[model samples]
Each structure stands twice: as C-alpha cells, then as structure tokens.
Target: MRSNLLPILTALGLLSLSQAFAPDPEPRWWKGNTHTHTLWSDGNALPEYAVTWYKDRGYHFLALTDHNILQESETWFPVATAGGARLQPDQVKAVLESKNPLLEERTREGQREVRLNRHTELVQRFSEPGKFLLVPGEEVTSSWRSPGPEGRGHPVHINAIGLEAFIPPARGTSVVDVLNQVFDAIAAQEKSQGSSVFGHLNHPNFGWGVSWEDMARIRAGIFFEVFNGHTGTADAGNENHPGTDEMWDRANILRLTELKLPLLRGISTDDTHHYHGGKVAGPGRGWIVVRAKSLDLDSLTQAMRAGDFYSSSGVDLQDLKVTPTSYSLQAKVREGEALTIEFVGARKGDAPEPVVFSTSQGAEASYTFQGDELFVRARVTSNLPHPAPKVEGETQRAWTQPVLPGR
Candidate 1:
C-alpha cells in the first residue's frame, strides 16, 4: 500500500508547489456606492432615509456626496419643491413615509422644514464591524465657461469620497487649472489630517463639457465615472463627441503612452437624485464592488486607490483574477440569461483604439496579455436588462479594472 501511494504524494507535492507561485487574492469583495445624495444639498430624502435604503439593499458601503457641502455641520433646510430643478417636495414626502423616527422636522418661521442629519450620527448608527459602512463624501460643484469651441458652462463637478472635510470646486481660466486646484485641496487635507480619501470626476460629457484632451491632461484626476445613471448626461457618443467608453480609451492611451502617467480607473455610479418613481436618477442603477479586508472607509478607499475594484450597473462578479500575464472574471449568472466576455485592450506604437482581443459565451472568460498588448481588461455583459437603465435596450455589464503591461 505504501509503495502504491508514493506516486500520489509526489503529484500532490508538485501541485502545492505550483499553487504557491500562482496568483492568489486574499481580500473579499465589498459592494458600495461612492456617489449618492441626501437632502443636505440636492437629494430629496433625509440622510437617515437614504442610508436606510442602501443598507436595506445589501450595500456594504456608501458615500453620501451632497453637492458643495458636507453633512458634518448642523443645518436646517426648508421644504422645497423640485420645480423640475433640484430637490422636490415629493422626495421629502418619500422620506416622511419611511417613518424613520430620526427625521428631524419642525416649523421654522412657519416654513415647513427638515434638519439634515449629521454625518457623525450616521457613522454611529449604520457603521457595522464587517457588515455595512458610511463613507463621508462631498461633491465639489465647480464650473467655468469654456473659451468656445468647447461647450457652455462646463461643469467641473468632482466627487470626493471619504474626505475629512468639504472640497470646494476650483475655477480657472482653463479646465486644467480648476482640476489642479481641486486635487491640490484634497492633497492638503490628506497631509493636514493624516487621513485618506479618493476623488473622481463626475459626468465628463454632461454638457460636452470636458474635452477628450482635457480628460487625458488632468493627470492627477485619477478616476472618472465611465457610466453615470443621470438621464441628461450622455453615456453614448454623438456626431461630434466620443462616448464614455471611447473617451476612456482615448484619454488612457494619452496618459499611459504619451504622458507616461498612471492609468485612470473607471467607476460607475447611480448619482441618484430623484429617488421617487421610476425616474432616471435613482439608486440601484450603478455601484462598485471593492476588494478589501473590511467594510471600513480606510480599507475600501485603499482598495480603490490600488484599483482593486470593478464597477457594475447590474451584474455582480463572483471572482476577478488579474496577474502580470493575464486577467480573468467569473459571474454568477441567472437562468436563461447569456454572457459575452470581451477582452478589450490595445497594442504598442501609435496606440490603436481598444478592440475586442477575445470573446466568449457563458459565465467565465480570460485574456492572456500578449507581449505586444499595452493593457488588457474584461467587459462582462449579460442579457439581463440593467435594473435602472437610463435608456432602452441596456444590458447588465461589469468592467474589470485594467491590467497594464507587466504589472
């Protein structure tokens, strides 16, 4: 019996040795939405109510990025109607219906009003050890009129996730100056507070605002929303402008090849403002799955900083494997649905537009990085319609973070 088992032991030893040298990922994937709103600025619902929505929906982390302000200060907002503009009464009504008990409401000078919940209260209430978390965030809503040839008042709105304080938008003669100001302010915060946070450019094509060249030139603007659920924001390209995917490729090529800078990471966000009805700007439309050790702000932000996350509109990836030589993904598919995994990347010299290097059907797909390939990333698409699709004929999709050459 001992002689017969000797060969099996040798084979087992070889298998163990090979695995020790192979790529092994240890962090767990924690789901979260870094862009969202509460009634502190433009969102309709109370912070408590909005947080409850995400927590109930199984979100592991969330950042309530109200425009131009943080929820840290105590303030009261009068009940206002949407008027097809910003916050509407209907959103407040939805909050009232929740019977949250924490909704602080009172009549100020005979005006119906609700006091915004403090971010501190939320961290105390919702933050669980390994279950759920609240990330402090703010939307730096800055804009500047382009020198023509570009669009109108180009919104340089940036979303800062888990920052220590509010970052006001910086305006400049050009897009680059404004962006630099915002990033510099964030850097200052990190240095002074000894804290960490991440920033992402919001809706690059909202008004044909940011030029493709501008996207490439803003080197410190390390992240941007590739897919935003706002209806007015054009996700697809028109006759003149490139679509989000097209813009991403163009900017990245310039950054990685010419600028010799770090590649920009892509994020999908709900940017939910109108919470009521089946409106376009609502939650559950988009979010990110972060590979991290715990559901804490530091852990998630660190993982995101490392580009150890993927954005999804509806699809959830069970496993994502990225190594120096290859990249791969696996999805938990529903019955009767189909998946098409496309390996999208480019080659060296006169960096060609990203094309599908490989394609496959079913749940799992992978792409081996050829020596010539500049970078390789997987786009997993399923036949299932996006839960909160902005346009018709939209299917659920997941974009793995790009794996660059030899890294």
Candidate 2:
C-alpha cells in the first residue's frame, strides 16, 4: 500500500510541474476598421477590391459595414451605374475587367453582360486564416429632426460589429425613440446569439444633431465614435457642443458619477463611403488598435468590450495602462515630430459642469485624480498626417484606452 501511494503522489507532482511550465498566452495587436462601405450599398468600390485595399495596406482585420445591408444576397445595377455613388474611370475598368470571364461565359449562352461577386462572397474569398480577416458588420443608417417642427431628417450612422445578419433601421416618431429602438435591437442580438456584437453611435457631431442630452439618456449604448474619417464629421474644434472627445468625458462624468449609469468609451472609425477620386477614398485615416489575446473575432470583441483599444488618426502608443489607483499612457512619435500625452478625468464632486484641466503638449504626461473623481481618459497627439482624412483640416490625433469608474 505504501509503495502504491508513493507512485500516485509522484505522478501528481509531475502533473503540477507540467502545468507550471506551460507557456503563457501571447499578446497580439489587431488593426481594424469598424465602419466601411462597399458596392453592395452606397460605396463606390466593389467588395473584393475594397477587401484587397485593406488587406494590402497591412490591416489585419476589416468590417464591411454597409448601410442596412449585410451583402448576403446577389444584386445588380446598370452597366453605366453598376455600383451606386461615384466611380473613377479606372475603378469602372477594374470592375469590368474582373467580371470579363463571367461575361464571356454569359455571352456564349446569349445572356446579358457584366456581373460582380456578391459582397459576402467577395469577403469570404479574400479572407484567409491568421493573415487577414473580414468580420461581418453593418451601419444602421437612420435620421433625426434637427430643430424645427417636422425638421428635416439628419443622417445618423451607427456601426454594428460581429453581427450575424442585417438589422433594419429603427422607424420611430423621434430620434431619441429611434436610437432607443436600435439600441434595444442590438441588445437583443447580443443576448440571443451569445456573440460579441458591439454597437456605437457614429459621429454625433457629423451634422451637429446628437447632443449631450441625447448621449446621457442612452441606456444600452456602450460606445460612440469620438472620431470619424469623412467629410463634415467634426472631431475637434469648439463650436457650441463639445468636440467628440470632450463630449465623451463630460458625458461619462455626468452619467457615471452624477446619474449612475454605466460609463461608455470612445471609438474611432473611417466612415468611408467614397472610394474613388478624392482624399475621402483614401485609407488609414482613422482606426483602432486593439490589444487582444488572439487575433480571432471573439478575442478582438472581448477586448473592445473591456475598452482595451485606442482610437487613432495617426500616432501609435508604446504602452497604455489603466487601473483604479492611476491612469497612464505613452506615445511613440515619428522621427521629426514631438509627441504629447494628456491624462483627463472628472471627479464625482467636480461638478457635472465641464472644465479643462491642462492643455500643455509634451512627450509624456500624467494627471492625478483628486477628490471624488468618477473616471479618467486620455488623448495623445503628434505632428503626423491624419491617418484617415476626409477633408483638409482634420489632422493627426490619438486617443488612449479609457479608464472607467469603480476600476
């Protein structure tokens, strides 16, 4: 009996040693664009071509977030206006050439001319294992009244990532009601599928329509675009409503500290529609670099859910850490330009009223939270080209991972 017990104990000790020696999981960075359009809806480039554009540009992941459609079924348009919106002459030629083989087969059977791959098919074809990935997504394009009674509907775009199918736009009597409906739909999807499908209010300042009140009352909204790459979407500047970044901080301060709602974070995206003949069609204007355990969709979404990403127009951060005690960030700069980092936060008793603490620029910086501070967030900027520039004025801006209340 003693001999048998001794052998069992030795085996157990060996098992424990094996477990201890196993390697820790590796950390990875996945660069992704959450909002994008393709020929399936209003975008100018074909889905296949757009996929190539991102994959070729070193983007590890992309989402084809067309408006209100999932690129599932096949559709067609006239040869002259095959893909809606504007198309450069070369874009037209590239599309037609790619479809020439299919056209020849159709011609032999006395059928009509020209066809392109369905958006889903194109994405599936282009996506490869561990190299590049295409995650299914969509923008629930809706509208709201600006001011006047029966005010003209202003466009409001919302990106839904990791969705299984298309979500129809919420039809309602008011913008607030519409937003609530959309939010509810997203929540339902998350509950039913047990999948990570994050939804964000896109570009509140795009039309100067969405307000602090609008964001304050949103119950299910977890994120809103702090920056968007497109014409007329204001990320900076002090015009009435706060800049998207300021709005994020003020809203979080009020909601979490004052109103006791869950805190929300900022997201940056290239809400790209034009893909031909302009600066808007260019890529790398805005993106989010997410730190995840793996490059898969689940891991990426998990990180996003935890606010483990930074929005960027340019500027990459070397390290970012957020904890209950303090918030810190560091930026890696380009050769010629200097870098600056700012730690921004609001205390619980610091008056729901907004205030700017410091506006100095430097290579590195930190802010101490005093009194009843609700949470803290940071922004890092550099003299680099805007990663996604829809217009001339918007330039490079980098935002750090948000550190929320109650750790």
Candidate 3:
C-alpha cells in the first residue's frame, strides 16, 4: 500500500527528493576557509593551534592545506628551530595548553622535537558535530617556467579540498598544461575515492605566473582566487598588468563566448601562514560562506559547486537569492556602515569589457535580469575598513557567483 501511494503522491506534486519522507529542509550558511598552512608545511604554528584558532573564532570549517603534504602521518618538529618555519614561544604555550595526549617528544641530534598532531588527532580533538569541522585538504604546490633567456618562472599552486590522500603535482609542458594536468588529477582522485573532491586555482599573480589568457584557456578550472589575504599575491593590478578581478571577468567572457567552457567562479582564501600578528599573512582575512543543508564536507562542497556560496573579506550576506529572472542579496553590517552593490557582467556581443549593469546603495539590493547577459555577478562593498586588511586601503567586501542568463 505504501509503495502504491508513492507514485500517487509524486503525481500529486506532494512527494520529492527533499520532502518524500520528511519535511523540506532548511539550509544554513556555514563559514569556512579553504586555504591555510600549519607546521605540516611552512606555517609557523602547530596543527592543533591552527584548528583552535578557527574553532574559537566561530569558523564553521577549515582546511589545513599544507604544501604538497597532508597532515596524516606521524611527523615531528623541533620546538625551536634555527631557520625555516618553526613554532614560536607563545605557540608552544598554546599547544601545551590544549593538553593533547597525542603530544610526544623525542631527542634527535641533541635537540628536542615535538610530535606534530596528525589530521585524525585534530579531528578527534577539535571536531564538534554541528559547531566546527576540520576538512582534510592539500595545496598541490608546483611550478614551471619557459625555456629560454626570457623564460620567466611561475609558481602554479592549486588547492585540493576533501582529499583522503596527497596528490602529487602533475607537471606539464606549459602553464595551461599544468592547470589542466592538476585538474585532471583531481578528477581522477574523485573517481577513485567515489566521493566529492573540489579543486581551485591559487593566486594567479603570485609570481605573475598565470596570465588572464591562461585562465581563459583552461577547460576544467572550477574556481580561482579572486582575493587572497597573503601579501604579494597581486589581487590588484599595477600600471601594466590586469588585476585578478579583471582577469576573472575577462576569463569568464572568453569561456562563455569563445571557449564554450563553464565560467570559473571566484574564491577568497586566507592562505594564511603566519599565526602571530604583525605578519602580512594571517587568519581572518578572507573566507567563503556556503549555504548547505549540513556542516559536512560533502554538503559544503556540493553547495560550492552549485555556486550557493559567496566569498567575503569582512562583509556578511543574508537572504541571498539567485534566480533565472533576478539576483539579490542583503548586507549584514554594523551601525553606520555604508554599502554598495554593483551588478557587474559581460553582454552577449563582441564588446570585451565587463560593465556595471546596475548599482544599488544601502543595506539591501537586487537586480532583475533582462536575459541578454553572458553572465552577471554581484560585488558588495562596505565603507568600513577591513579589521585585518590584506592590503593598504582594503575595505570589507563580498562577491556572489556569476549567473549565466538563459543558460
């Protein structure tokens, strides 16, 4: 009788995937930072300390993406090292304060070394069912250069999120080739594991490495850093070069009109390495707020893939809605904080530059699509300065994913 009623309920429009057996679910926005470094790589803090930092600060999830290494193995680092990345005196105090039982010490070469907490250990210590989560990830660090006198070297880094194991850097003949190779490897891993794994292109202008043309040419890129908190990332362009924002727009235009590929969404990441204050790279600079059903890896990544997320430096968004006919969002701000919402996108013609479709000023804004756009995205800005500015004169901002009209 129950099986016979299922088709009748479905035909009556009462049964669906989300409401077939239970009431429709309400999704919540989860804050997370996808890029971070710790003692597992060149970061100047312990893994436990880093996890504590985010958890205590109300971050829902974090990915400790060390360079080419996952925090899965038993590794040890000397408390005080001569050079390279080492924990400071204060960080050591915090590490000890946690009283992690996994903490162990040993004597090697007449110097005492402390065991670096593994990812599993951090999960056991830090992960709360609904409060906080530690997502396993790695930064697939790789580089390439042209072969000649004028051959400039470029660092091509990609962040792989939700990894069960380390992904070796896939080398290729050129920059585009390298991006494609790494993307393919990520896909292969997702296939092998039979789970959700996401990849994003790191800072493109780190070494002036990836050009906008290279970004436009990539066929498999899902996302790229439009705003990175680390110094020397070059999010803003100089007199000669285009910034990452412009690069994103241009790449999207080309991908939508010429390359016939999916437009890459923008991501904001801390890429934080410095734990102590006073350094350029630190936590709380940038992150993504994702709308998902639950605070888990698969749900978050799925929402991110579906573009149900926004990247923010300091500004927060509420009631964000993206539909076929319209795109709208409301800014969550403090007292007297001014807001500006710009609908920026490219049209369907041959004009290359992206223009502002509409601009709204105040706490909330919405724009109705005329259905002739290649893609339209929102850029929300607040007059309040970033508490932890990535660069001088940086203001609080949030960016929504681009919507392709008539797609």
TM-score of each: 0.87, 0.84, 0.92
- The alpha-carbon deviation from the true structure for residue 90 of candidate 1, after best TM-score superposition, in angstroms, is 8.2
Q: Each model's C-alpha lDDT?
A: 0.80, 0.72, 0.86
Best by lDDT: 3
In the range 31-135, model 1's lDDT, one tens digit per residue, is 888889877887767788789889989999889999999888878877764365344577666666864345677886777777787998888878888898888
Candidate number that wins on TM-score, 1 or 2 = 1
* Candidate 1 to truth, TM: 0.87
Q: Could you tell me the lDDT of residue 109 within candidate 1?
A: 77
Model 3 per-residue lDDT tens digits across residues 252-315: 9888788888878999999989888765789989999999998998898889888899999888
Give one digit per residue, the lDDT tens place, for model 2 in 1-407. Answer: 24455556557774454454557667777888988887767777666677777887889899888889887774543334334435444564675576322211133244332445665566557777777878888899888765677677766677888788678987776667777788878888978888778788988877775776677667887788888887567666355767887788777776876567777778877777776647654556788988887777888888887888888888777777765666667777677876666666665564655554445576666665564555667877676656455545555888875565445
Give the candidate number with the greatest TM-score: 3
CA-only RMSD, every prediction: 8.0, 5.0, 4.3
Ranked by lDDT, the better of candidates 2 and 3 is: 3
Q: Which stretches of candidate 1 lie over 4 Å from their true place?
A: 1-26, 79-100, 148-151
